[model samples]
Target: MPLADAGLTAWSWNPLTDIQVMWSYPFMVNAFRAGAVIAVLSAAVGWFVVLRRQTFAAHTLAVVGFPGASGAVLVGVASGYGYFAFCLAAAVVIAMLPGAGQGHGEESALIGTVQAFLLACGFLFVALYKGFLGGVDALLFGSFLGIGDGQVVLLAVVAVVVLAVLAAVGRPLLFASVDPSVAAARALPVRALSVVFLVLLGAATAEASQITGSLLVFALLVMPPATAQLLSPRAAVSLPLGMLIGLAVTWLGLTAAYYSPYPVGFFVTTFAFAAYVLARAARTAATAFGARGPRPGTGATGGTPHAVEEAAA
Candidate 1:
């Protein structure tokens, strides 16, 4: 698989031909499949992560996967097991910290402490590895060259299970996110929901790291959802819109990386950041235009002012 040879010297004018050439390799096929699965899972869980204001916790979980992968390599096992095990364990540990009911300042402090510790452990594991570790660049940034059938299947199965669990708890979770005090007054299990969501977020973060690497997983996890929220406030629209944005960026990144000599993470992050900037500009323009429009009950028809309209009402 001359994926290293830059099989595609130049993109043709024909879109179909370009796509056909790109998809000819089995590795490319697996890369696309794995990227799609990770994007969907990350975007879905990321919406909640943003809504619950748990981006700090999400960042901690993402970093936790690095040490997990490194430790797995040290112990002579598949990295996927280490990714899930360490991330889930870290999530549970974060949830069980003593600052549950206290302010976010304390919880965030504890989460940051854990993140720092795990990162140091990752460096230690890397130092302990006696082998050449040729794939260290891929571990930190990203590479789409080595995705396989088994990895694709594993990603798909994990995405299905995580999304299903999210769907099961969607409403109560939303209620709790919006107003935890009110939800608790109604007998909802706020704490339990928080723990479950963190675990799921951990799982999603770990899986996403397989393609984007632990450092750049936020390209999928945060950017798309943040851009979607800027476009629309409604969850029904923004949630799936975020997924679509993530999937688009992933496919675009894979395609770009295949033709260029750069890492996939760079392309993915660049594309997502571009989309967010565009969305922000559009929102700003709309706000400015709306402010300049005619006020309520005072249009070109010589309508009464808002005060007059209210008086008549």
Candidate 2:
């Protein structure tokens, strides 16, 4: 069934009227509720993902969800269960795989190995299935259709649990992410924190995959947090900034997809990428302009190492 029915009106000059029309539909309402939950959780967890430089691990967990959903279908089970089970399981495996204090090369290799294996398994499941996988496109690219009240409530509950846990560990996780050595020296449970964060990340990834799909989860998972970081240095500012950006892109993507004959993931990913690019350009322009300005305590006008760091910082 079409998310926006034929009876729905086209875009109008009045934004309020347009929104009212969109909200009048049950599917659109559920979609917005689910999207809001996913965006907030993804943004919150993803900020830590970027801060810890664990984008690879996050990507791997996202990929794991595809196999989970496919395998669930192979066994005649609900895909949602498969998504969460596989993602959370993969997260645990990744966490226990000797990552802390390990070389980046080793960590990346391990993560890549898991991602490749799971993705291959996903294809194998698809091949083995006798029935047509009609929802494959929706599984991979996402759709605003079929988001019912139950899914929205489930997503909201999961989001609340994830957010609460994150809040409890927020300070230590931030410290450990910024400087693990010092955090460990201070007797903080750096390893434990890492594991907890990974599990949370996995859950968030699974939830996000339902809306943005396994491939494009990064639209919400990485882009908004990254853009927010580019715009702000302080953790306090960047974390909430990322959440707002996630909400905006998600809502806009849903609205646009509802009106057009396109997938929600594409709109979400494009808007996120555009935001990241704009933030990058603005930061670059500011840095360049600062580089040309006269330095304080010295009359020389040029980009110095300290000057550049100061401007960029």
Candidate 3:
């Protein structure tokens, strides 16, 4: 049998055509447009998230998004209002919570408490609604099935504003992240930078929730940047490359969800997880192979041995 006829999927055989066909649907266009924007924004904000080691804060901001939408539903307002309001408010509160002299344990306890409180409130809001919260699952797990042009436009606008801020503060933020003490010594406003970045992170988390939902934000916000960082630590290469990977994953997920009977979030999370696993495997393999060979001045009777001897002496 011909390879194309051997039970090959339409996408694998003619990927571009399949994508064009998917794009024919207006809903899919909205999904792709929103997904692409969200993916890039998440990657950009998320890289610093990884650099700053603030995964818990990111997770809390995402969880807070649930209550934001649910409360909006209860109040007869657009869900976007709740998402941004709640997430941004939480970011501010977390930033204001004095970190000075607080032990890691205490800070974690505070963050965890906030998450628990927000989650409890989210459930309460859902339960108190008079009628069934239609598409509640979609709000929780994310859905691109009915994404509208308005949503796409809002996402683009927010992305522009957020990215502009990121560009303006990227260098100082990097310095602060790498060495807070030195940055502070250099009068870099370390605490202020931390707060500003957290606010950006919260915004990114809320934006990502629109696509991946509050429940599984790591699909885009964490995984793509994490995988990219593994591939390269330099921000210049990894940051943009991570955004590319995120866009690819979002497109693939949207395409797969269009054809399958599953939610977009599931496909998106799966793709991101797969990418992370593949990156880990490749890095492991490279390390294993790279370790097998010795350096030019390494192994017995070389610069490496002489250096060791000198250190010992």
Candidate 4:
């Protein structure tokens, strides 16, 4: 059989079989694996991020790690692991900062300063390590096609850990996120939990930044959860739904990028943006329909009958 004929036959087979055939192409397989892992981890952490309004913090950490990782690469180190360590350290330090309160204007300013400094440093390191220019570019823009099995395995572990942590503290996290005042009144260890969650989120962000790059990491981490929240108001349903949507985005984006000329980040971010738009539209439609309800004192049995007699008298 001609190679093209065999390829068509494989494509027409079961989805799993089709995926396996595609995996035979090394870059395609690695890209799909990397995208899937990052999506899961992102959705899991992102739920809390949206709930607590810490999306900016997540973005800052990812950006800060870019330069740190580049510096490590310049010094002949494991850039990926080094970046993860640096991000975690930064998370701890941020958590400990006296005036670095959450969701505040000042906090954003501090994060912006850190991000700018790190990015500048990253550029310097990249210039210093000219021999690894291709690798640095891959780190900055991400190339799903070039991911290796080891990176895939590492992402898988991180995804699993993130899910487990989210599950273990899912309820309290939500409680703390939406109503910290009430949570604190109930003695929920709001401060400590916030710090711990930030650390875990930092780790996940570092892992995700490896594939999506710091610039687009928020698309994977924030968009899905935000979209899910629009689709479902309940936290329980929204969390799982967000994961499902995230997985779909990753898988579909990877497959689409496999055939398209665009980069993986473009496809991933596009998929997320489309999801967000759709979710917003759905929410608006639902609100429009739900608003067509009976007005106060306008229903047949809602008003006082005696008031009519009193007015007549």
Candidate-wise lDDT, in order: 0.80, 0.83, 0.80, 0.73
Question: Residue 63 of model 1: what lDDT?
Answer: 88
Q: Give the TM-score comparing model 1 with the true structure, all chains together.
A: 0.87
Which residues of candidate 2, in runs, are more than 4 Å off?
1-9, 100-113, 128-131, 292-313
Per-residue C-alpha lDDT of model 1 across residues 69-148, encoded as one tens digit per residue: 88887888767778889888888987887544223664667656766888889778877887636666666677787678
Report each candidate's C-alpha RMSD, comma-separated, in the order given: 6.8, 5.1, 7.9, 9.2
TM-score between model 4 and native: 0.83
Which pairs clash in model 2? none
Model 4 weakest 10-residue run by lDDT: 300-309
Candidate 4 residues lying further than 4 Å off, grouped into runs, are: 1-21, 99-110, 134-136, 293-313
lDDT of 4 by residue, 1-313 (tens): 1233434433454777767766787766777777777887888899888888888778778887888788877888766776688778888987887646364664677666767888888888998988776666666765565467887787788778877877888788888888999999999999888888888888888877776776788778899999887766666667777878888988876665554555667777898899898766655554454345432223221122222222222
Write down the TM-score of every candidate: 0.87, 0.87, 0.85, 0.83
Clash pairs, candidate 1, are none
Superior candidate under lDDT, 2 versus 3 = 2
lDDT by residue (1-313, candidate 3, tens digit) is: 1212543434546877877777777878998999999999999999998888887778878898999988998998877778888889888987887762122664667666767888889888888986646567777888886578887898899989999999999999999999999999999999999989988988898899988889889999999999887765457767997898899999898788776667889999999999898776655554455454443223221222223233223
